[model samples]
Target: MVQYPFCALLMLSLLIFLATIPNAFFTQACLTTGYLRADAYQTRCPGVEAIVFAGVEQAVADDPRMAASLLRLHFHDCFVNGCDASVLLDDTLTFEGEKTAAPNLNSLRGFEVIDAIKSELEFACPETVSCADILAIAARDSVVLSGGPTWQVLMGRRDSLFANKGLANKNIPAPNSDVATLVSKFQNVGLSQKDMVALSGGHTIGKARCSTFSTRLKGSSSSDSPGLDKDFLASLQQLCSEFDNNNMTLAELDFVTPATFDNQYYTNLLSGEGLLASDQALVAEDGIATRNLVETYAEDPQAFFEDFKTSMVKMGSLKPLTGKSGQIRHNCRIMN
Candidate 1:
């Protein structure tokens, strides 16, 4: 009789102990098994999507170029550290951030807009949301507000505690890359050649510094190689010569439609009017598959929109830290 009572007491104690465990522990465990989803924040942070879009829309209204800047911010963040928002970190005494990397130093913008969105979110939900998710959402909203294709962005990505300046410099494809090099870079990041061509169409709404494309305007080294249009090259030279400083002069990447996200980027490429060497390389002789993709997108805006939507989702899915792996950062620029 005594042994039976002791066994019953032990079992009851174990049940009580298990019941005391926090629900978050189990929720975190479940999140480890799958990729993030569009509704990840539906319960934890209601109305988050609206808050992000409103902030992005207001910023774009103030400066139309902000749409492109935010989109580039997402791309740069993902390529370096897998959509972790490490690019948003500011340089501190103990930590060096991605802002000073070779490719991003003066090129990347829109941090203030991100900060504004985060402030609004913090007021509404406190520590319930992550900065990485905010960036992903802001990028999508930027595209939609700029007349680009809209897609559902996955959430629940946690902010990274560390930033990689070296990887940012190394992984970002250079403006002067050849077709093969561009293809290789995309492949290394698990993006297909078609994805590369489609994503490059983002150039439809952005501007590039003169220093990024001035070499191509100097004339081709080989006569057999195709070059930009003579008149287009002259126009570029004139626009880029306004300031003695090479980096200060800016030219629209898609001259036909600089503010709209459309197939005009591919159309411009077809006409030998691509602003950057990497842009032209997609249609170069060696870029058989990429050239085909460029022509297809130019001829069919619907196809480009569909494929770009898929590619953006695919890019955002790269190596996210979910579950109990990383923290939901209160401040995007600092580690908690």
Candidate 2:
């Protein structure tokens, strides 16, 4: 090895110390084993995930509208890098001309929830942890706290080097994908149709902007057209005379239990209350497998949690620049 200046060597040692320290006892960057497998990380994620979820839950419980904002965090991340929280930065792409379907227009209320949780954590633990991890865990917890499902979580994920707005526009699946297309999209990210439907459970707890549902309102195409409960559709029409194609007027995926994580999302589908045309398609004639997933998850929260955990693991694995693939950033929003 080439000899270096004492100062340079000291700096290298310090960097290693910081990275490892984050994964040690000071923060939630747990170390059950090593980085070679995801199971090692799983042992550490749930507890932290619960904390984040609790903060989000409290932030939005009394006000259902806040759910939309909280839900946007997950949408922003997933669209960019399989729920990786890589689209919340100032440099990230915004929805551009011709209506780029990126993860912009996040719910402002949701940011408040994360900020509150960060404040509490800082008060309790000081600077031992990172806010980026809090964002990921909070998004996960928000779903569970909203009565979605108890996701099987893993820990030890380093924050992203950069948050890409442009990337979000390219990766997020639309609200109107057909079964085959959705399956392919999820597969590209190492998720299954089951994961797609379960992750889509986020829809149960949030509101859609009017822009997201404009096509549904006009019945643009069979897949784009929503098959909502008759009464709910009428109520939606009353809420907006014509779709503004904005976030304010979108219908939720599960209206029956929007604030709670339960089987009701599936039950809603069975009842013709599925909020989007894509959601409805999960149970359409040729979509029995997916429909059964809804039914199965509805019947067993434990099973759902298992699938959710597996799916989350798979989702995180997609296109990851791990093991020297990507550099850890001091700030999650910027590329170092």
Candidate 3:
């Protein structure tokens, strides 16, 4: 009986020893398959996150809009090809790039900022860092700088050599998409409806062009159509009226706090002041679950921040290239 107890204690001791192994060992093993981890660059490029954050902070200081722009860049990059930084590619004579995609052309900004960050990293760490990882880090910093929650971003993502303008156009959700369409698109990428609602909160800091939501002002012929507030619709019509040269005219997604990342977006939706059809669709009568989510977020900013961080991390993890699967480009805009 004493021998059996001693054997049981010995087995327990062995289990404890195994549990004490550093997580980096397991992370390194998973890296071969492109698995992302918080400390993927801790040894390879010691201060990569700080370097990227400094660049982002400087850019945002120069142009507050850059915070939103950087956030949107990561979204566009991930939605199309799984955050591979393919969206950063410039069109070459041989191949068209995603920059001119229907969803991104003239809409996506902040490429120069990303290029600057990549140049700095190339100087500091040479080819040790990846543009894909830079984008993920910049996005998290942008949110934090804009008064949002901060989360540890998974690194070790690799950049793609090719760009897909077609997939970008198809994958990036339209500003006019309804809740159901938005939910379906998110579901296609392994995200749930709740994730869709939470991620859409990103609009809290961005701007949209008149062309993105002018259809709402055009007025529907059907009486049962969900209508925007008359005053809000009138303002949008006036803002979008100069259609000839006003295509580039900008409107804040969340007018209440255009430069801050917060829950005012959901509150705007409740007041019928949502800038995009998709934004309004979240709180529409037809979307019970989504509307409930909007209500929850509107009533609780902390909940929105927590969920947004989780969803952003989830979004960033999609189909990344790692461990010799893709190259780390010298220039973010060109293949090296």
Candidate 4:
């Protein structure tokens, strides 16, 4: 037996401790601090999800389109800076807010809806609930209210003190994105290509501005977009021409059952009715992986629902402020 010195034993113990740590802490770091759990507010703010659902139900009752808008808020917020509610901040003289970002300006509705929900939450639980968690819960409720899948949303996220307007513009996948671009955008936020395809299903219930897919219409190029259906192309052209390319003029992302959250979006992509260039690219221009996913989801609604819920829960886990790292803002629009 060999005898080891006290310093050698100490060094060996230190190395063993370091080896026990997760490789992700060194290789792929969580951009934000903290851990979130499904039962984060079980005691502090019990039935918080139900309260948020009530608010979302009322909002969706007022306008069915709001379901899509609220869902988009969670996507936009998570893509920029983890799951922090930085996207909720309004611009101030001292600092810029994500609301004015290129990807968000004039679009990204449902702010007033969030404010209304926040008001109710403040009355019920005071500052115990974070605005970030509200966005997540509201997103899930919005989907369920629209006849989509329901998932367990992990809570305990805290509101961001500042917004990243530049990241908002650069990070959110643009409507004109191709399959490769979409994959890259999602990957930048630590999401997989499968997650990207599934999350894009959220478009099943939303509307897009005419400007988003105007180029896919006739005459923008000598030839129509690849895999663009001829009849769908003609209708879109008429719609755009009628609006004179007005950005305010809108078209449903999934025209068939537009307000319903269903697998019809994938079915549309399979038949080439996908509205945005980024949307159709999944099945049209893309090969193998994404196209296969598009096919799988189109044929199996249950598969789509399961994958979508998994993706939503995964996306919600992005960099969150946990363990008292951030404050629970009294007003979602401003830091507390």
Per-residue C-alpha lDDT of model 1 across residues 1-336, encoded as one tens digit per residue: 445688899999999998998766554444565558877766567799999999999999999999999999999999986889999998887768999999999889999999889999999999877888999999999889989889999877888888988899899999999989888888888898888998999999989999887777566332323546767777887787777994578899999889999999999988988888899888888888888999999999999999999999999998898877778788888887
Candidate 4: residue 325 lDDT (0-100): 74
On residues 19-69, what C-alpha lDDT tens digit does candidate 4 reach at each position? 998644532122234667777776567778888999999999999999999
What TM-score, to 2 decimals, does candidate 1 have?
0.89
By TM-score, how accurate is candidate 3?
A: 0.90
- lDDT scores of the candidates, listed in order: 0.87, 0.57, 0.88, 0.87
Runs with alpha carbons beyond 4 Å of true place in candidate 3: 1-30, 220-225, 242-244
In the predicted model 4, the residue pairs found to clash are: none
Off by over 4 Å in 2: 1-54, 61-68, 82-84, 92-103, 106-109, 119-128, 148-152, 219-232, 242-247, 298-302, 316-336
**Candidate achieving the largest lDDT:** 3
Per-residue alpha-carbon lDDT of candidate 2 for residues 227-246, written as tens digits (9 for 90 to 100): 55666666666666654444
What TM-score do all the candidates reach, one by one? Answer: 0.89, 0.69, 0.90, 0.88
Q: How well does candidate 2 score on lDDT at residue 247? A: 43
lDDT at position 163, candidate 4: 91
| Higher-scoring candidate on TM-score, 2 or 3 | 3
Question: Rank order by TM-score, top first?
Answer: 3, 1, 4, 2
In model 4, what is the error at residue 266, expressed in angstroms?
A: 0.8
Per-residue lDDT of candidate 3, residues 169-218 (tens digit): 88889998988899988988788999999999999998998878866767
